[model samples]
Target: MHKLWNRIPPLASDYSGVCSILFELNSLNILYTPSGCVHPIVEVDEIRNFDNVFFYKSNLSDIDVIMGVDDKFLAEAELLVLNNPNLEFISIIGTPVSNITNVDFQKIAEELERKTKIPVIIFNTNGFESYNVGIYEGLLMLAKGLSKEAVRNPKHINVIGYSTIALGYKYHLNELVKVLENIGLKVTFFASDGCIKSITEAAKAAVNFVISPEGVGAAEYFKEKFHIPYFMDIPVGLNGISRVLKLLGTHLNVDLSEIEESIVTRTELRGINEYINKNVLIIGEPLTSIGIRECLRADFVINNITIITNLNSTKKSREIYKEDLFSQVIFVEDEEHVAKYISQADIIIADPLYTIFIRKEDNKIFIPLPHIGLSGREFAKMEYEYVGKMGFEYFKKFLKSEV
Candidate 1:
């Protein structure tokens, strides 16, 4: 047996990732697994609010797994497509059972597509990989299957990689859109909010703004196929927002003088400078951790930072911003590893699941930020603002009051 406890729970599984992307589009999403496999995604994640999107779960019984029930799976999919004539697309997501049985989900998807004349996408997510991998694969499949060649519009852009798993993502994206619009840029489509039609129209946009690292695959696909360049940055916090706007301005050759002035004024008005002495520990996906770190360092001068993430540190994430704020960057898989670092921090910013590992005697401040992989949407009802000047203000307020 291992000496240390494996405290770190599995981050959002691959199926969650496929569901996150599919939930945004106008498609009928079906999880090919037993009844229990669908609960975590449906009850805990953000799909609870997506009443318009159709989602179904297949009944894979004991005999089905032992004896192979490909016929049952195909018939169920056929029935759904026949009943819902207006359905744009069908996505079949795999679970642990399907993976173990070596089920040929792709072949079944092809068969379904041929029979119903409806486009079908399959993700063989066996719950072994994390959400980031799932999101990358899901987005790549969407781009490859749906994007078509078209004339480009210099003024339009498609924002990619805004997922439901991000805490307060809707508010963050809305603010980012407002800032872009202020600079006279049109957001043709938000990749996370579009369907097959949106993916087809992506070729018309001049650029793809990859807000998260997960969207990089989709952005690269557009670049090679449509000759569209991408700007990789999630504009969070005051400094984070300013940096993104400046980059956007340079690329588009637009004057963001007014926007810059407004951002500086807003930061000053928020009085974020008062909390410079605070120390923070950030843990999450790579881009999110980086964005929050940049924001905290720039606005509040919280330089005593430590970043713990599931992604590799060498893959351009550490070098994204020239100014380094992280004192230590730890890539972790075990709970004991996370515990060693958490013991030294005064403020902990992470998913709610990490709270269980913290010692009761340790006097530390915790700000609950929900992550789909960690706590899912259990605490999504509690709003945590972490984008734009106003988001920074909310962050400052959170620290001042919570600590």
Candidate 2:
């Protein structure tokens, strides 16, 4: 029987790429999903090597938050902060009950901070908002707390929106640091892969360039609070990097050599892209799904793009991306269906659950998790050699073998 405390049904996308990303970035074991949605989270944990992830029934009865009012959450925060004191930043996410009860998260956090000397911020994640909004807001809250520190140096530039996961962050951060430093921009700060010191010095940066929608709010907060200019857009692949260079050129009043390098790199990727087989069915998070699908389909034909996700509170991906661009699109809720469709596809780019389903089969290939931004494409291609040197190599290989 479903637990009484669990409220909402699990999102179909819960078990794969999106779940993996959240685990890698947030350092969370159990997501605070409603009890009814248990299966999706369970399924997501089935395939991946996620060690720090677990699920909690967040459907706190109205009585619990309003009347019973246990200090569980506040205590949990204090414990986490104490353990990770460098956690100068703390973000609190509220479930439906906490939202409706009008629980004073700020007050609770401030009280905890007063006693423990740690900063805690609150982000409301009730039904009104989607994960896209939740992630951005969470980032903003984290940035706001961080803005309190004095500037250490003007060369400090923060990487907003890339991520907190181990998958792509390792490669992306290294490349980004090299690109910015090569262009004479002193590196300031980076998130996900950033240290506590850099985060503490966030207010000191001259400007902020946000690469993901999730990073946009933090960029804006830094801009408004510190008089630092923030640029919001993707900074991956060739075109995305060019866009960043263009914006930086305008801000710093100088020509950007990064633009030249980005163009050359993109041209090289495009040449490699031509050799890739096109037929594919991509299953992952929306941002990664759309970005990868859009890039791959630019000059090649993508047979179909399927999003396997559990973020049911958000609209299906078919509505997220323009429908006219794809040959077919579907939002799947069942793993059995996902496996069946993948079996027929030439290539598959998805999380480990899907990967394990296809791993033993000679028909499909796995593309790994956290495939976001244009940069992920090149990373996938060159690093994995299955997509475009940086984009969709396994899918390409699968298609070649299938045809």
Candidate 3:
């Protein structure tokens, strides 16, 4: 029954891993339960050098879970906010214990906010749902808060769904800003590490880019209430950028060819197409998993693409790439198990989880194919950002290798 329920959940939570991504994106200052393990600490430490981070400890006990969020912890949070004059907000993430207790987190946050005169955002992080659900819920919470403080600014567009958890988010955003500015469009918000003032100006943008489905609800809200136009599923690849520019053209009533030439066309697709015929395993967010699957097929005779995605979050991407292309596309729930399968494949494209174990002797080429939407050119930008000047050094090696 336990096994059945584990598989039955539409989107099981992997909180430890997801929170690390959230932290990498600089979206929140996560508080840890005393009993929590080292995963968050490790991931947070990895990304800490890239951004500002602060942590707080909450010594939650089993007794507290059975009863509710200990009043003492809430009081501690309030005290911490009061002591830190520079603090802007506090996020209360739900732990497994808290979920089991069915604590009224919203009430606790409201009380904390009222007490500290600081914003308290409650996010459910029970490791029972997929990361996308957590991201979407977190964004919704952010939107609700921003809505109250939103300022009307016309001609700016909010870029939602590209969180800091993604590799090379800074580089990608900078490039995007330049591309949009070249076309005379102003970027209003980044949705990740984005300034509060800028986010409040979201209503000011002429159109919003629903870069990921996580932003779908926010985009719909703005369109319905503020009459802003929205373009959904604009990812980080050369062709993906082209699709975005075309959408912008339609919205602005301008020509798209020039924009495409300047951004997508000038860039080269990494010659990985020649090796696409080799059996490859893909694991990451659905947008990335599915987008790469289609993009690679254009160049390689993609044998199979084993996916590690929660179906609910990847519905849109799934609709784009049916089960026909791959010899088989399996939905994975465990990272370790998936990694073992990846070890058997000719090539592997994924985030750090899968890449951490690959060896030179295995003859399995590993590409840092994060699902953040970089095509050939955008990926180059990422390689430069995190890996320093050696950017693409590893990826390029993969491209040159024969499957």
Candidate 4:
């Protein structure tokens, strides 16, 4: 089998991504597939405890699947709304079953919206693609459905595309907020908290800081509709943090010299004053890999860095990384492609599950940087630093022990 793997598994599909994006938002999110399809996420990828009523699995039966019964789904939706009447919107996320059945998700979504008099967003995230596409379309649907006409708040900002599972927890927002608040700019809205208020307040932000590829669609929407200036970047390394600050300061017209100097001061306090020259490989989604690659180069002074990932960035995301000459992004076609890079790397930093691709006897340094999308909650340490200043510091801890 071309897709069979000895150890590594396939990334979570699109419906999971869409669900993760909507996980924290105050909306009625339903997966339109057999009940079993929701298991991969609810038991593993999702950190939300049970008893949460907003999210549901449509519980399609053998007859419903055979007949393609839209009425069965609508009846369930009507009951959910009847119980949770204060919902701002409803989202119908699709999975592999829907794709195989060739269901008309859009028509059903239109019918649902018309019947309920609330916004119904069809994510169209059939299980064909990986989670990034889900996150991308999920946020895009969110922007399309929720963003409103409002006067812009000059110092206000929204951190889009940063959700649990793929990007770690919303505490990453706290790290960035600490940075933004120091420079007289504040994060007015962060969507990862599962707060519906963030969705409503999105239109007023002066800038939308896109943290992952998933947010690209939503950021573009804000720019086009609200005329808000947004740039795509994840705060990872020391320089990566500075780069984001520079992007934000330019838009908000604030001074960041004090903040930049303080980051250096804190980094120096960590006693990291060495240029670590080694062949290193970073793997995972483009969002995480790209951030770690940039962090390694600018912070560790490692020039021989290379990245391998299964996910590719948007055209605009590539442009964002074009100026990053320190490393290159390789899209892995198969396990062999990954084997080739890990074979060359003296050190590897990625999700722990990628260990399946490497040799156990090799004298290579493998640092555990667990991504929730890859390893689920088994390995991802939410407080262990995955973004911004704290992210770099956490990475530096690995350098101290392994490098």
- The C-alpha TM-scores of every prediction are 0.88, 0.59, 0.71, 0.90
Candidate 2: segments with Cα more than 4 A from true spot? 1-102, 126-131, 149-155, 164-169, 188-194, 235-243, 257-259, 262-283, 286-348, 352-403
Which residues of candidate 3, in runs, are more than 4 Å off? 1-32, 37-46, 50-54, 59-70, 148-154, 166-169, 234-236, 266-280, 297-330, 333-347, 352-365, 370-397, 400-403
Model 1 TM? 0.88
Clashes of 2: 34
lDDT measured at residue 104 in model 4 versus the true structure, 0 to 100: 93
- lDDT per residue (tens digit) for residues 1-403 in model 2: 1122122233222122233333333332222333433453344322334454332344444345556353765555556555655444444455554556667666766877687775555555553433444455556655665556575455556766654221243454455566678776776544454255455567777778665545666777777877788765443344444555777777766777755564435432333343365346666545445555655544235435555443332442223333343324465545566567777766567644345566564645555553322122223323432122243333344334222
Q: Highest TM-score, which number? A: 4
In terms of lDDT, the poorest run of 10 residues in model 1 is 314-323
Off by over 4 Å in 4: 266-275, 312-327, 401-403
lDDT of 1 by residue, 199-306 (tens): 878888878888776777888888888788888887777887888878877767788867787755543433345446667888876667778888777776677888
**Model 4 lDDT per residue over 1-403, tens place:** 1455556777777787777777766789888877888889887777666566477888679779878989888988988998998888898888888888888988888888988998888877667677777777777877787767877788778888876767776665577778778666657545565677687778888899887766878888888888888888887867777888888778888777777877644444322344266788888767677788878777766767787776534443344345343145676667777888889898898888888877778978887777777778787553476567677778777677232
Candidate 3 RMSD to the correct structure: 6.6
lDDT of 3 by residue, 1-403 (tens): 1122231222223343244334532233544355663344343323335345545556666566565555777777766665566765677777665666677777777887787777767776765544455556666666666654355455567777665443334564566677777877767554554355545556777778765555666776778877778876533445455656788888767787875875554224434556655677776555545555554443233546666542332443333334363224565545456557778778777654445567778887677654332121223234532121122233345556343
TM-score of 4: 0.90
